[model samples]
Target: MNADRTKYLNRRALMGAAAASLGLAAVPALAQDNSTEMDAPSTGPVHNNTSSFRMLDWRPYFSDTRNGAILVDTTSRALHFWSEDQSIYKLYPTSVPLTEDLTRRGRTEVVQKVVGPTWRPTPAMKERNPEWPDFVPAGPENPLGTHALYLSWTYYRIHGTHDTRKIGRRSSNGCVGLYNEHIAVLFGLTKVGTQVLLV
Candidate 1:
């Protein structure tokens, strides 16, 4: 009976180890599929392009200290406006919509800044928003909102959007979307040579 009990215990231990190994082997396959899902493009047609969107009321203040540029943290959904002279000046919540396979980290310069900018959909964007006019005029109706900080990259712009609700969510086609009032403050703080660090 003693020998039988030892054999039974060993068999149970071996079964448990085999089960754990099977689970470990399955993990890589599941991880691979999850990555593939994230890489997929978002579905559905683009929504309305009207300026009926309400703008956020933002109040702006400046510090005498000159911070060099801006840093946008998409994961944390925050924007840090720093003065070159000081470590920090202002911080605002922001949002970025990314593709499933998208990955961006580190810093880049802001090459240009525009106020009340127009929206010119890229050929790819146009394909997605066929109903979108060739150019959207500047105003409350414009998706670009009241300010835009053009990044070093041609197509990517950090701009205010009429869609204020998107500020905390990952929802933009690719651009960084800010609240109208927050963007206006950012516009005042930054210039063509501003550095944008994304992490």
Candidate 2:
């Protein structure tokens, strides 16, 4: 088979396995690092990322939903949020760390919220990629997308990405990434001091 077909078959197998392992009523994962061919065929209804997206309860991950609560499950590559009043809940696909060494688990909080946020490669990022630009102003080329939720941990964020393909995969250098639209919705739903937990 051609390489394209081979890749699709591989992903199809992976998604099937993900469904079994997650015991999904049916669901999916977060995304790949670079732009990629759409995983679900476009000729019919799209169901590529639904197999592992089952809903979850905040009680298991939070003491209270004060100022809202955000949960990032790196394993499943999903992000869950609950409003402070417990009236709103959202689950969005996310791109997690590229490796275990880049992952940061445990509690944090939204310390800042920025729209049209500028981008800056972390010191570590610059070290690894000396050729990368030192800074990028807010715009289409900015990797941070249109919004960002700065976490309490330095250099860590739950932000948007212009590249939609990164939404459901282990693509991020360190931060969690969402579709620009999803992050826009999340940015509106969240606030500074919103409690966040990553696992």
Candidate 3:
């Protein structure tokens, strides 16, 4: 099989498993904070430096226009943003990986947009990193670098991370990660209700 096709199959299998582990009907609406009622099964401890893998070479898939919402292709590691005219004009290569579990695969709605967003460690995250700050104020050091689009799903976000070298690689715990500058560009074009498709 082609490399892309093989990657897609692997992702599909992971998504299937995740969906089975978590009841499909119980999936909660996406929310801004990670403190939502729906709890995602613990996927083992998250490692901070999982981005050791090199980024694959992939061109961004984009719409012809720039006014619509964004859709991320986790398998291909690309982000597509549609325009008002129903064209996808902006595309960014992504390094973040979706959670391998099927429960994390599906459509989500962007509920909020924040620039220079702060990073707050969730209870789960805090457990893994005891030294993690209660909150990292927005700035160069913040995990959420310059832009963040909050999805309704708890503990998941489409945001800019400091790991630009990891773009086009599997790195994030479950969120869609982008480079700081790229996310800043995406932040300007997106709004609430932007549909996020993960396949």
Candidate 2 C-alpha lDDT tens digits along 51-134: 146578899998899999998888888888889998877888887776788788999999999999888777777666777777
Instruction: For residues 88-171, write the lDDT of model 1, one tens digit per residue.
Output: 356666656544333455657788888878777667766765776677778776777788888776577788877676666665
Model 3 spans with C-alpha error above 4 angstroms? 1-67, 98-103
Q: RMSD, each candidate, Å?
A: 15.6, 12.4, 14.5
Q: How would the candidate models be sorted by TM-score, starting from the highest?
A: 2, 1, 3
lDDT of 3 by residue, 1-199 (tens): 8999999999999997897675443332421011111112224443233322112112243322233556676666777666557533566676554346522766677888887787777776667656657777777777666788888888778888775655666656567777777788778778787767666
- Assess each prediction's global lDDT (C-alpha) against the native: 0.61, 0.76, 0.61
Q: Tell me how far the alpha carbon of residue 51 in candidate 3 is from the true structure, in angstroms, after superposition.
A: 14
TM-score of each: 0.63, 0.75, 0.62
Q: What is the overall TM-score of model 2 with all chains considered together?
A: 0.75
lDDT of 1 at 190: 77
Q: For candidate 2, what is the lDDT?
A: 0.76
Best by TM-score: 2
Give me the overall lDDT of model 3: 0.61
Stretches off by above 4 angstroms in model 1 are 1-67, 101-104
